[model samples]
Target: MDLHYTDAQNAFRQEVRTWLAGNVPAKRLPSFDTEEGFEAHRAWERKLKEGNWGMVTWPKEYGGRGCDLIEWLIFEEEYFAANAPGRVSQNGIFLLGPTLMEYGTDAQKARYLPAMASGDEIWAQAWSEPGAGSDMAAIRTKAVREGDTYVINGQKIWSSRAVFADWCFGLFRTDPDSARHKGLSMILLPLNSPGVTIRPIAQLDGDPGFAEIFFDDVRVPSENLLGPEHGGWGVAMATAGFERGLMLRSPARFQRTAEKLLALYRENEDTASPATRAAVTQAWMDAQAYCYSTYMTASKLMNGGAVGPETSCNKVFWSELDRAMHRAALSLSGAAAELDAPWLDGYMFSLAGPIYAGANEIQRNIVAERVLGMPRG
Candidate 1:
């Protein structure tokens, strides 16, 4: 693998770096889980839209620069390196947007893509449930079609950004007689619609980053369904590929965190243990490995190759790396760790990384069965 960047890619990298240096906020915005923070992040998204950097890999007609996957990777490097505020619209830009590009009707794309790009409609993912968080094939949420409308009735839990989001996309059992991943429909729902209720669930940070959403006869136009009705498993898988593949957990994020952890150790080496130092070095190396692997994946994707189940491996590796890196930081904090240290908060969040994207145990099984051709017992 020729891992070298071409002159053009290098130019794109410089462009991204220069723009981020000039535009990233001097002070970080508030956490996007709060009401005030939601609006602040929206404003920031608009700022990115104004600069045509909202989602660079998107087609130019959709308010992006039409950059390729490599350029997109470069953009991510600059984005995290600058310590920019977290993306409040990532669900829209990273997950749902790609699915729409692949399966949405032209009318659906025209209606939602631009608004999503501008952060006029921040999106939440309503994929998990109390009973089916890891086993999404067992989702029980139902949406029944009547004439031109679909009435939804069920519940979704662990919905990221549901508290302050304008829209959500999820799978519903459109054909109740069907079982497992079959007979489901991917539907986009307006959060403020009647019969819809959102209850935010507080995280360790005491912020409602996730929510439990209930739908009671919640109705939307049947036109909102993505892909074919009862044929949504394909669409859902494509979206999951994007989520587990690269967009949600880019290498740049871990690299930035690893760098910050090292800086903390350097400033207090007298207080740091040799084991902590070794762990820090390991974390940095792991992050670099992720970046290189992602680079290879991007290259393959750019060349028209498909992403497959192997992405589960990437998810497990990065999530564990995240936990180890944060744990080391908290260890260094010592007594200060109890006083609301930043590392403490990060450590708490990292604990969920293994669980949120698909429990690491499930991922290991997938790697065993699908990637290694192991048989399920």
Candidate 2:
């Protein structure tokens, strides 16, 4: 409940702020604004690696700084506040790396972790399909075992970053006869494997960030299976926990965005009306609430409390707030909204926030049933 930062924590933030001041490149600030912007992000990630700031919470054996969760949050806050480019290896660093740390073999960690930290390999999530947009348990991509390898055959649509990624991490149907969530298996597939085809899908931002991956008898080693084969639903749940919570957009991270949104509003208030001011104030308040919620979550983790289904609440809140803030920004732009106003692209990109990671509607259902103890649909 106590949200105060210790003197040491304050010192850590100052250290991170100083490092970012010297290291973050000004021109690369907008690289996170589009799919193409990842190229600049990759270069910036290299700069972070040189300082051992890549995935600071990982074990030191895997090239991380072995820092605490609070330290990592401080670093994230300052990193975003500096307007540094997004991490080019986000899929690898945030999603896959944590999944591997929890469920992967030692060999798997050794093979991928260092390379991921150094930006030598990029990964994408292969989830969501034409038919399984929100009901991820309904994904139909099948992986049939044959001798020493699994022959994966099916289509995965909306696979973010897959168009240019070198690897894919996702769940597949290892046992087609099993119904619902059973028989699912989390697997890894190299993009260069034979019979795999990738088709990029354009977004509102005019970037091919999402892709459709068609696996036609693609062969992958059975060793790529994460955890127990049929127990992948549990593994995937753990993965989703990270996706929505600290692993993706940490609380300190959102605070940084809130700071920028405040600055933007203050600078342009001369053109904003009373209604705009009210909306901007609401956005700022919501962002502050997000920070408080994240702090509670962090305290729970630090105290060895498990992050359960409740993390979905944070995901729904922040993702929607992000969309709202961007929408307000676009409205403030008036006729310039469509003219590549920096905030316009932000507005367009925010539209995808509720849809990706897991739609807000789906998250509400989860909170109702699990958190609120309500009846199911």
Candidate 3:
């Protein structure tokens, strides 16, 4: 139950803080309102890569610092604090990286990991077909195996960043006979492959972060297969576990956000309404809980303990907390929370927190059944 960081960890935090102070550019924060903001984020990601601070937790063999998880957490804190940029390669870095580390061939790792680590190749997740959504086992995209290649043909909806990314990794039906979770295979495909088309899905915030991808006889090299054929379900679950769980946003990041919200609250003497006060207080408490939860998780990971359903709970908690905080901010701002409002855009964008990274409801189910030992429906 030790929640305190060691002296060495504090030093690591200072080091990250110093580097970010010098390197973080003075750019306006990104807005979900326009494509320009998204491009700015990508540019910032390139800057981070050039600075050699991207993917700090990955092994040095993959162009990372190979730092411990605590150091990674510290770095994330500083990154968010600097308001640097939202991760443009998050799906690739968080979901696919660990999966490749676990199941990819040496050549596959050599081919993809370095470029991904360096942010030279951004990636998107090609999961969640229109019919699939939460029931990922129901994905209908088919990949028929040909000699030395797999010709893929299907439409993937809600494929985040596919419109701008270079690669996508996901499950495809390699065996027509396979039903439910069986007969699926995890494959990596280049987004620029012939016959592939991407159409953006405009969100309420007016950003095209999600896109629909059509694979019309698109062919990928057979060498891109990860793990065993018909064994993609396991690989996908592992990838999702990392994606929806711990690797993307760490606790310190949440702590910094919460602190910012608290500062906002403190600066407003008009936020004296009982409800607003209570909401702000609750947000602060939730932020601390998120920090503690991440601390425990980082400790466990450092001790060689694997992340399981517990990370699902953390994801749900922190994401919902973020939404709550932003909601409170809107409430505090009252009439200024509408479109063209000062706080309107950010508050609206925060609304998507619960929906991304495996919707909060699904995370709750994972926590209830897999982590809490509750019986399934």
Winner by lDDT: 1
Local accuracy of candidate 3 as per-residue lDDT tens digits, 1-377: 66677898898888878878887767665652246665676676777777778788888888788888778877888788877667788888878998998999999988998888777888988888989987888988999999999999999988887777889988999998889899999999889999999999887766787899999999998999999998999999898788666787676666776777677777775654777778888988888777767767778888989888777877778778877877877776656666475356656666777887678898889888988899997
Candidate 1 ranges with C-alpha deviation above 4 Å: none
**Pairs clashing within candidate 2:** none
Output the number of the TM-score-best candidate.
1
RMSD of each: 1.1, 1.8, 1.9
What Cα-based lDDT does every candidate model obtain?
Answer: 0.91, 0.83, 0.81
> How do all the candidates rank in terms of TM-score, highest first?
1, 2, 3
Q: For candidate 1, write residues 1-377 as lDDT tens digits.
A: 68788999999889888888899999878889898999999999998888888989988888778898888988999999988878899999999999999999999988989999999999999998889977899999999989999999999999999999999999999998999989999999899999999999998899999999999999999999999999888899889889889888889999999999999999889978899999999999999999999999999999999999999999899999999999888888888888876688789889999998679998899999999999999
Model 2: per-residue Cα lDDT over 195-305, one tens digit each: 999998887766788889999989999999988887888888888999887678776555666667677778788998888788788988998888767767777898998
TM-scores, all candidates, are 0.98, 0.95, 0.94
Q: What is the lDDT of residue 56 in candidate 2?
A: 85
Q: What's the residue-level lDDT of 266 in candidate 2?
A: 80
After the best TM-score superposition of candidate 3, give how far the Cα of residue 280 lies from its true spot, in angstroms. Answer: 0.9
Each model's total of backbone clashes:
0, 0, 0
What lDDT score goes with residue 295 in model 3? 69
Q: In model 2, which range of ten residues has the least summed lDDT?
A: 28-37
TM-score result, candidate 3? 0.94
Q: Where is model 3 more than 4 Å wrong at Cα?
A: 1-4, 29-35
Please give the RMSD of candidate 2 to the true structure. Answer: 1.8
On lDDT, who's better, 2 or 3?
Answer: 2
